[model samples]
Each structure stands twice: as C-alpha cells, then as structure tokens.
Target: MLPKSYFDIFLVILLVPILNLFVYLHNSFSTSLSYLGLPYFIEPDITVDADHVSSSSSPATRRCNIPLSALLLRELLPVVKFSNLVDPPNSCSVCFKDFETEDEIWRLTNCRHIFHRSCLNCWMGYDQKTCPLCRLSLVPHDKEEMYNERLWRLCNNCQL
Candidate 1:
C-alpha cells in the first residue's frame, strides 16, 4: 500500500479546490442576497416542543404584492434632439433592436441612458430595476421627473 503521507497529500490536493468552490458560492449567494435587500440572518419565531409546536405570524409569511402602477412611474418619451447631443443613439441597449423614428423610448432620469419603451418596461417589471448599462438605480428619488442633461453633454464631449 502507498504511504500514509502520500494519501494525505492526495486528499489535500483534491479537497482544496472543493473548499474554494464552496467559499466562492457562499460569497456570491451573500452578494446576491444583499443586492435583493434581504437580511442576511432571519430569526424564526416558531418553536417545536415534545408534544406540540407553536408558531407566530411574521412579515416573512406575507406575500409581496407590488403593483404595476409603481413600475409605470418612469418616464417614456420619443427620442429628441438636445443641444448637448451631437448624435442620438439609434438602438435599444437591452434588446439590441434598432429604434425607428417614431419609436417610443424610456430615458432613465438619473444615468440618462435610453432604451426602447417596451424593453425598459419589461426589464424593470421583472428582471432588474436598475440601468442595464451603468447599473444605476432606476427609481427616482422624488416625485418630480428631472432629467440630467449634463450626462448627455458629457457623452457628447467624450464622443461615446
């Protein structure tokens, strides 16, 4: 039989990558949970006894019923020419579909990145509530719809 040291070395070589993979997965899961705004540790209120179990209702048991009206708060408009823009974008960044002259578009008020109205609507409704390009929060801070014209000017200056 092989020496004990040889077996130990072989086991170490096989286990290191597996341990690293677990650590990576745990970290990635924690990061995603943070992005979703969920608490890392949730304390359960239910307790089990030898005879019976007692349970108390908590906010976690309730279903989240976000309304469609909430998602429609973002502004939708036609592509327009601003003094800051040398040339306007012709395509939707999310779906990679070309925009037509009369196509409706959604312009994020914060980052000023634009997308097709339908594409942005679907994206914000289901996938992510952030700008696909810069990962900025799409939710407006106030009820007022304020456009950041400086971003457009900066993009024009950079020729991007």
Candidate 2:
C-alpha cells in the first residue's frame, strides 16, 4: 500500500541498524572469546614480533633456549606436605584458599616460595616457570645447566 520511495526508505532505516547490530555482536563475541584465552598466560618470559616491529625500536637479546620439560620441572619442584612445612602460609597465593593438612603443596626451589600443587600445576600449564610471589626463576641457577643438558639429551632437540 505504501509508495515505493516510502518502502525504500523504511527498508533502509530498518536494515542498516540490523546490519550494524549484527557486526557489533559478531565482533563482541570474537573479542570475548579472545579475552578468555588471555588469562591462561600469566606472563611469557619472551616474545617475538616480526615483520611490523623494526629491529631499531627493540633491543635484540640472545635467546635463552631454556628447557621446559614438564616432567623434569616437576622433579625440580618437590611436593611438600602442609603439616610438614617449617613455616607455611595460611592460604595459597594463586587460589587464595586456606591450606589444610591433607592439601599438598609445591615449593619453588629458587625462591623457596610455596603454592598449592593444583594451583602451581595450573600455573605451569600456562608455561610459567617463576615463583608467583617473588617473581624469581623457578629453576635454580645451578640446576639450569643440568636441566638444559638432560632435555637436549633426552629430546634430541636442535637449537636452530
């Protein structure tokens, strides 16, 4: 019943907002999904940005090539019984949960900082290898050599 121009105007008014809303929602969902993945990484020790970032802007540091074998790292972090702790914290730093006698904890050798085993393993699952409290290397300085040697020998990984 409406004139063609009226119909055209009505469709333009309706469809433009719908299209914009669709795009906005799609981007929002994509952003939210991307946001969900960000929390897993506490902080990576190293990052490489190529093509866009020029060498002049950033200092080039030699790669550490640190071995991060989960099995070997676990051996370095000895599990401690809560009741046996010489001076245990009341709660875990990562989860902020109270420690119980039954709860097992892992000690970071370098810093002597302790965390709930589950919390520490979850942190390690994110490829973190630092004491959560002290920000010190989880791998002891002396043991780093042995760790690298064992990893390379066992895994036969090439540096290049």
Candidate 3:
C-alpha cells in the first residue's frame, strides 16, 4: 500500500476539484430556484362576442387622459421668491435649473414638490401621469372617476 502521507495527498488532490464543482452547482441551482419563486404579473384574458363581429379583436379598456385645467395651470401654481422655498431651495426638481423670478413655478398637489411649469407640463404630457419626485398618480383613481372629475372641473370653470 502507499504511504499514509501519499494517500492523504492523493485524496486531497482528487476531492478539492470535486467539492468545488459540487458547491458551484448547488449555488447555481439555488439562484435559479430563487428566480423561479418570484411573482410575475399576468395580463387579463380577452374575449370576443360571436354576434357582433368586429374587424379588430382586441380588449377594450378605457384610456385615461391628462386633465389640464386653467385653474391648475394658472391659480394653483403660484410663483414664489427662490429664497423663500422650504426644501430643495432655489431650483426646479424636474429641470434641475435655478429658479429665477421670471420662471413659472408649479408645485405638485400630492408630494408638494416644486418644478418649472413648462418642464412639468412637458413631463405630464409625454413621459408619465405620475409625479416625477414621488411617483403619485396625478389623475384620479379610475378612468370613470377621472372622466367625471374632468367634466365637473370643466362645467364649474365654465359656470355652466
């Protein structure tokens, strides 16, 4: 038989790579299982009516529109001295530009964060309906509620 030291060295040489490979495989499997356990969002099913045949067979969900009122644009947004700002003093959060007296300042209703009127308008028009700073929904909760709110605002503004 081989010497005791020689046997130990041979065993160490043979087992080290095997142990490393086993550890690597175990870690890889654990990572894969962890990913698999994560929750995923699923879209609702679309159904078509047999009687009323339509050209496009797509799900019809009401789309929400941006509610831009004169009150919100003009009166709700008040210009203040740059020095008078409470937090994030003297700058628009959206544009990261210094607030000059001539610049139009608009504060978000939910988060109370201030931004430039032109910058916030552009952002709300194109990018998102949520607040840039707080991610709060600028519109009403549902499409129907948003529609009703818009109509109410319009009627009240028009004195109808």
- Least accurate stretch of 10 residues (summed lDDT) in model 1? 46-55
- Which lDDT values do the candidates have, in the order given? 0.54, 0.67, 0.55
Candidate 3 positional error at 2, Å: 98
TM-score of each: 0.39, 0.53, 0.38
Candidate 3 on 1-160: residue-level lDDT in tens?
9999999999999999999999898777767755885211122222222222222323223212333332233333355544555664567777788888666566655567778777777775563667788898554343436444654644444331
Clashes of each: 0, 0, 0
lDDT-superior candidate, 1 or 2: 2
Off by over 4 Å in 3: 1-88, 139-148, 151-160
Select the stronger candidate by TM-score from 1 and 2: 2
What lDDT score goes with residue 41 in model 2?
A: 40
What ranges in model 2 sit over 4 Å off?
A: 1-68, 157-160
**Candidate with maximal TM-score:** 2
CA-RMSD of model 3: 16.1
Q: Residue-wise lDDT of candidate 2 within 4-100, one digit each (tens)?
A: 9999999999999999999898777767756986421432333322222222333123222333455457666688899998877899999999999
> CA lDDT of 114 in candidate 3?
78
In terms of lDDT, the best-performing candidate is 2
